[model samples]
Target chain A: MKYLPYILKHLRKNWIRTASTIAAMALCIFLIASLQTVLAAFYGTIDTAATDRLITRHRISLAEDLPMAYEARIGAIAGVKRTAKTNWFGGVMGSSGGQPDMRNFFANFAVDAEPYLAMYPEYGLTDADKQAFMQDMRGAIIGPALAEKYGWKIGSTFQLESIIPPYRADKPFEFVVRAIYSVDTQKYPNHARDMMLFHWKYLYEKTGQRAGVGTYSLQIANPSQAAAIAKAVDSTFENSDTQTKTETEAQFVASFLALVGDLGLILNAIGMAVAFTILLVTANTMSMAIRERRTEIAVLKTLGYPSALVLALVLGEALVIGLLGSGLGVLMASTLIGNLGSIPGLQGFGSVAMSAGLAAGMFAVGAAMGLISGLAPAVGAYRANITSMLRQV
Target chain B: MAAVDVQSVRKIYKRDSQEIVVLDGLSLEVPEGEFVALMGPSGSGKTTLLNLIAGIDRPTSGKVIVSGTDLTTLSEGPLAKWRSRNIGFIFQFYNLIPVLTAVENVELPLLLTKLPRKQRRERAMTALKIVGLADRSHHYPRQLSGGQEQRVAIARAVVADPAVLVADEPTGDLDAKSAEEILNLLQTLNSDFKKTIVMVTHDPRAACRAHIERHLDKGVLMTTVERHDVAAPVGAR
Candidate 1:
């Protein structure tokens, strides 16, 4: 323990090298932890998806819309308790009326009011808010994150210009905010906090599209019978022109993320590459430090410090640097993600957190990195010939 | 009993299939409290003999018994432990750990003992005071002059109160006045503390401080010359 001061002094002797190595390690660890947290957030959404709900989409592709009539048939299925239809409005809050740039764009879904609220109990809304939303045809429920972002209070009106017209060709679709909804950010972190939903009847009436429904979300009474219910719903529309694919909500979420590419594989590749680069950099740094300290190491041996002690000292120095670098990196990553919640486009996605288990895993990686990087140099010092090393100076 | 016993020791090295003998059947003895110097030219095995006596290296064929323990028989681990307790070494370059302060360097060997931190610190301070460098104890090696660094090294050597002090050209790197000061300090350590000193130097002036001087040539002890300065040996306290 008394040798710690000496070890620290040795590190400080080559301050520039030590600082650069630590900086490199910190940057690598930050990249790794950030990538891992993003991957975990994507998977966490899938993992926490409601198992009692099932989604029925067009079998060919999600872009293909099914008939609105299928919602009634799917709702009448054996175990289904309620059903809701949603259409992706694909609207952009345009540059009109002093709005900011294109970054304010968010998901706007036209959904059936009563049935959608019934199917999604995770979205916590007050009874008064629900009543107001049901009463007004032009009323919209905005996520709390979205409401806070655009400073939209209940009763405030906003317009979304449609990117895919003729929902709004010359005039934007105007919506009065009726409710601010909140969801379990731990589960639906990217969804309920960044989305807006108005009445599907409004879109139907304005666009005069009577039979189009993008997808149907069904809630079943018996969650264990979800597979049977999904199979039955798909079989009902099998031979029809608009074939349907039904899956449990978790599987549906997983498939949706799959469209974004193989997130897990991509993250793993990035992580391995970063770790390998850090290992090389750290190993080189430790090698240089050991090479420079040969005489000091020999002096320690002459002072009756055993070879094992010498090896441990070298390894301990590496461990200290690794821990310092990794700790700073992870803390910075967590802080950045935590504070990103207020950013316009990054609202709900900012809820991605550094879990305790992930932090512990990163710490283990740091320790292993330190030990492995220092191994060759520590071994060299341990087996060094005291006579030869003494002659070096 | 003799403080150092080198009994027919030999040291050899192999360099890429060629055999080299650095020490060939060299033997010597020095009684307790006697100051002895071994003088030889470069590659004459003077430092090799000093290393053997300090138990920092092992002989190829024979025994190096320092203070009654056979160093050649002890394995590496045990030899380190024995050396920590019985031997203190000074090198030509005054090998003080450059990063450590003078006091920290002096307190290093005492860390191997069971002494508490306070006791170790006190002993190190006492050693620095003995070498007249107590005020410079807080300074690092780079902050000190060459002579000051050697004084710190001497303090480090004696801090653990080892039975024998082996010095290999301790004054080799110093100027004339510093060299004389170092020699005087060594003489004080030998006479006042009754430390058994074995120094290796090629300087005749440095060798004159010893009670007995030995000459080595080509890995062999050639002759012993008695110095004019003689004193009765002090028994161990």
Candidate 2:
């Protein structure tokens, strides 16, 4: 601790090199943390899935729709409480050519609003909003992120063109924004905060094409009996034309992620590559710094500093770079995560965040990067022969 | 007892397969409170002998002792501790750490001790005062003149109160006037503080300031001369 000034002064000797090395490290940390946060949001949806809730979908694929009658049969299964129906509207707003550009897209769901809202207590919907949405056939409730994005107020009306073939209206469907829903982004992934949900009956009355629902979300009375109820629900529809697959919400989300490819492996591979690059950069800089100070190091030895202390001083310099660089990077990531909705093209990741545990882990990675990078130079300093080094002077 | 003893010391260097002998069967002794100068040309092994006495290097085949400790027998760790306690070294380059202020450079050797930082700092100031550089304590090496830098180096050397001071060309890099001032400073350290001093220099005038001058040729001691007239403290004359 008493030798800190000596080490600090040495770092300041080449401020440009030191600052660049630290900046490189900070960039690596930011890249790795952002990639890891994306993976966490994907996997976190599974980990935080409701234990007592289950989703029943078509056996062949989620793209195929299931009849609304299936919800009643699933609700009759033992340990089943209630069921809600939902459909992806695939709506594109203000499209001149009637084509869906992803940039102008927000997830819109035609849903049995009461049961769906009851199943997700984390959404924090008010009774007034729910009653107003129930009274008007064209009323709609949008996520706060979507509302802020389009600058929609409670009484504002908008038109959406259906992208799906069967539900495409000759004249665009009009609806009034009844409420802007609130969600705790820290507690839930951004998917819920970046969506709009309206009544499924309105879609049926407007389109006149009853294509049925995409899935049935069932609330189970007991989490322990979820597996049994799922099995019973699947067995009841075994011989039907649209066979159903029932599982806990967690399993459903996990399978959905699996279909999207191995995100965890991809993210980890990127982190390792970035870390290796940063390690080489920092090591090269430290080697150059130490090489330039060979004579001064010899002088220190002549003053009776042991090889061990020399090693410690060199390593301490690298460690400070690592800690400071990573700290700055993580702080930047936290700020970006907090204001994700305001950043264009990053609005979908409004719920992507760095947790306290994940932040601690990132700091450890930075420290490890520093220690590993410093190892070779520190050893060189330790094994330096004082007499030979003095001869260089 | 002799403050320094080199008994039949031989130092050899190996470059590739060639073995070069820098010192062959060298034996020398300096009694307590005596000042000696080693005078020789380049490659005469004067610096090599001084390094041996300061415990910075080991003899190849013989024992070297300083301040009651057999330097040849001590391991690297203990030898460093012994050097810090008993020997102060000055170089022709001044060798003050460029990043540290004058006083900080002087305080470096005391960092090896258990003294509190405040006492170390106070002692460093006193050493700077002795060299007449107390006002320049906050100045770095590059900011000072060559002569002032050497004074700071001298302060650093003696700040630990080592029993012996070993200098290799203490005035080698200074101009004529600065060289004379540095030689006078060394003479005062020896005559007043009673420090056992061994200096290696090619300058005849620097040698004349010491109590005794030993001349070496090709790694062998050839002559010893005593000069009593210039041995008094520089202030007295």
Candidate 3:
């Protein structure tokens, strides 16, 4: 503890160099942490997906619509508990009087209320809100994040202009907000928090497209039977014009992310590059500091400090720098991520906040970097010839 | 008993497969509480002998016994521990750590001991007071003058209260006024505190302060002169 003052003074001797090195390390750590957090958020969507639920979409592509009649047929199959249909109602809420430009373009789903709510119990909604949503055909349940964003209340009415021409083209679709739902952010961080769901019957009636849904979500009695059920459901429509591709909910999310690219390989490559750069910069800083203190190190030895103590002192200095830089970097990244949730069009990307596991992993990497960087310089100090060094200026 | 005893010590350096002998079959002794000065020309092995007595270096052959402990018998770790407790060193350059304040540099050796922080600080302060640099304790080596820095180095050397103080050209870098003050301080430490001191120097004025002066040439003792004007040895006192 007493030697801490000495070590600190030595570091402060070259304050500019020390500060620059620390800042460089902090930037590297921030880049690594932010990248890893984004990757974790992408994978988190798959990890928290409901195991017992299976999604049935068009085999050719998700843009193709599936028949709404398949929901009833899939519900009749063994191990099938309940089924719900959802159609994507592409809506854009633009800037209006007394309202700031939400320019809020989001995935608004037209769903069968009762079955969809039952299958997704993670979305917490009040009983009163659920009842209100079920009673009104033109009612919508929006996520709390979306409600706060657009200043929506329980009885408020809002108009969403449909981009798809099949829906009301000249007149915007007006709907009353009936409820606001919340989900566990820790488990489903990447889950779309700014979502709006209205009645599929209302959309079908308004569009005059009587018998089509975009996707079907099936709830199975046993999660272990999901693969068998998905196979049977897909085979049921194998020869038909509207062929189906069925998969577990997790697999569906994974495949959706696969469209982006190979995220794991890219993330690993980025992480390794950042780590190597940090190691080189920190190692150079430590080496320079030790080189300047060669004579002082010899003086310490003449004062009866053992080689091991000198080595520890050098390594401890490196550790302090590493920890300080990494800690600041992570804190800065966390603050940015937390604030990103409030920005428009960035909610989904920002929803993936830094996880505790990743934060801990970053700290460990910082410490390891310090140890690895300091090893060579500390060894050089330890093995220095006290007699020859004393002769040096 | 002798505070420092060197028995036929020899030191050789090897450079590119060629051996250069610095000290050959050199032996010397200084009684407890006696101040001795070694004067010689450049490369006359005075500093080399001082290093052997201080336990900072080992003899090529023969033994170096200081304060009744044979330094050659001890390994590097134990020898360091013994040196810290028994020998205090003052160098030509002061060698004060540039980063530390005057008092912090003095307090360094005490850190190796089991003393609590308060006690260590007090002892360090007391040592600085003895060297009359108590007021400059907070100043760093760069902030102090050459003489003041050397005084702080002296404080650091004596803070551990070692049996013998080894000084190599202690005033070689100081002005005449500062050099005289340092020599007076060394005389006071030897006479009043009864600290046995071994100083290696080329200055005859510095050698006159010691009770006994020894000259060396070619790694061999040339002559020993007793200073009649100086106070009697501690035993006589």
Candidate 4:
């Protein structure tokens, strides 16, 4: 601790190099942290999924819809406690000129509103909002994030154009907002308030009972019986017009992510590459810094500073750079995450803010990188021959 | 007892499978509180002998007993601790840490001890006062003149009150005026403060300040010159 000033002074000896190295570390750490957060969000849904819930979708593909009649049959399954039907609306909100704008795209869904809301206890929906959504056929429940983005209040009417089949009409579908649901961002980092849910019956009736359900979310009585019940549900619809594939909610989310390729591996590869590059950069910087101070180090040894102390001084400088870089990078990441929810394309990631654990993990990684980077030069310092070093010009 | 005793010390270096002997069968002794100057040419191995006496380097196959401790027998760690307690080293270029102020540079050796911070600063200030640079204690090496920096280096060397001071051409880089001041300061440290000084120098004028001068040539002691002893004996102090 008494030698901290000594170490700090050496860091400032070449202030330009030091600052540039720190900046490089910060940028790399920031990139790695952001990549890790996105990866976490993709996998977080699995960790936070309800054990008692299962999702049944078209076995052929998610693009293929399931029969609305499957809901009643699914509800009758032995371990099934409740069931709700839902379909992806793929709605694009209208711009000021009343044209579909892809930038305002959101995951609007037509759902069995009451049963769907009941399945998700994380969404703190009020009784009044539920009743209002139930009483009016055209009433819709929206996520608080989406509502805030469009400034939609209860009873506010808006037009949405469906990009999916059988719902493209000359006149856009109009619906009134009945409730804005809230979710705990910490508890559900991936399931942010970026989707809208309205009565499925309204879409069915408007399409003359032609539109089918996209998925069925089922709450089971026994979580342990989930696999058996899923098998039973799939077997019941085997060889049918639209075969059913059922899985636990966690497996459902994982499969959905898998459809976009191995994102986890890609993210991990990116993180590893960035870390390796920064490690090399930091090691090079430390080596140069240590090399330049050979005479000074020999002097320190001459003054009776032990080899261990010299090694520590070198490592201490690297650690300070690592920590400063990581601290600044994580701060930038958290701030960016705070504003991500308002971005149209990244609304779902709004709630994926940096956790304390994640932040600490980043700092640990930075510290470890610093330590590893300092090893070669620190060993050189530790084994330095004072007389030989002093003899150098 | 002698403050520094080099017993037939031999030092060798190996370069690309060839052996080069820097010092061979060198024997010397300096009594407690005696000031000695070692004079030799570039490759005469005077610095190597000084380093062995200071315990910064071990002899190839001989013993170096400084302040009654056999440096050859001590391992690197204990040798360093022993050096901290018994040897004060001054480099030719006044190699003070560029970042530290004068007092801070002087206070560096004290960091190895368990002394309180306040007492360390006090001792450093006292050492600086002895070097006649008390007012420039807060100035960095770059901010001070060459002579002032040398004085600060001398202060750093003596701050721990080691058993002996070993300087390798202490005023080699300074102008004549600064060199005289440094030589005068070294004389005061030897006479008034009773420090045991062993200085390696090529300049005959600097060697004149010491009580004895030993001339070396190609790793062997060639001659010895005796001067008037200015400082009292250790017992008298």
What candidate 4 gets wrong by more than 4 Å, as runs, is A96-99, A146-159, A184-191, A206-210, B229-237
lDDT tens digits, residues A1-393, model 1? 877887788889889988888777777777788778777877777877888999999999887788988988998889999999988887777674555334657778899889889888777898999999999999999887787778999999988876654465446778999999888666555454767889988887777664378889898999999999999999999899999999998999889989544867886798789889989989988998899889888888888889999999999998878887888778877887776655566544644678877877777788788888999999999998788898886
Q: Write the per-residue lDDT of candidate 2 for residues B39-155, one digit (tens) a residue.
A: 987998999999999888888989898888899999888888888888889988999989899999999999889999999999999999999899999999999999999999999
Clashes of each: 0, 0, 0, 0
The DockQ scores of all candidates, in the order shown, are 0.67, 0.63, 0.67, 0.71
Clashing pairs in 3: none
Better of 1 and 2 by DockQ: 1
Model 2: CA > 4 A from native: A90-108, A125-133, A136-196, A209-211, A222-241, A259-261, B231-237
Interface RMSD of each: 1.0, 1.0, 0.9, 0.9
Which ten-residue region of model 1 chain B has the weakest summed lDDT? B228-237
Which residue pairs in candidate 2 have backbone atoms (N, alpha carbon, C) closer than 3 angstroms, thus clashing? none
> Per-residue CA lDDT of candidate 3, range A1-393, in tens?
877887788778889988887787788788888877777777777888989999999999887888877887888889999889987887767655734244566668888889999998877888998999999988999887778777999989987866655665446778999998888766656676778899988888777665378899999999999999999999899999999999999999899889544867787788789789889989988999999888888888888888889999999899878887889879977887776665666555634579888888888888888878999999999988788788776
lDDT string for model 1 (B1-237, tens) is 999989998999789999789899999999999899999889999999999898888888998888999888888888888878888898889988887899999999998888988999999999999888999989999999899999999999998889899999999999988888888888888888989999999889889889999999999999899876553322212
Tens-digit lDDT string for candidate 2 (A259-367): 4447678767887898999999899888888888898888788888887888988899999889878987788778877776555455567646788877888798888
Please give, as one word, the docking class of candidate 1: medium
- Per-residue lDDT value at A295 in model 3: 82
True contacts kept of each: 0.58, 0.46, 0.48, 0.69
> Alpha carbon lDDT of residue B1, candidate 4?
94
Which of candidates 2 and 4 is the stronger one according to TM-score? Answer: 4
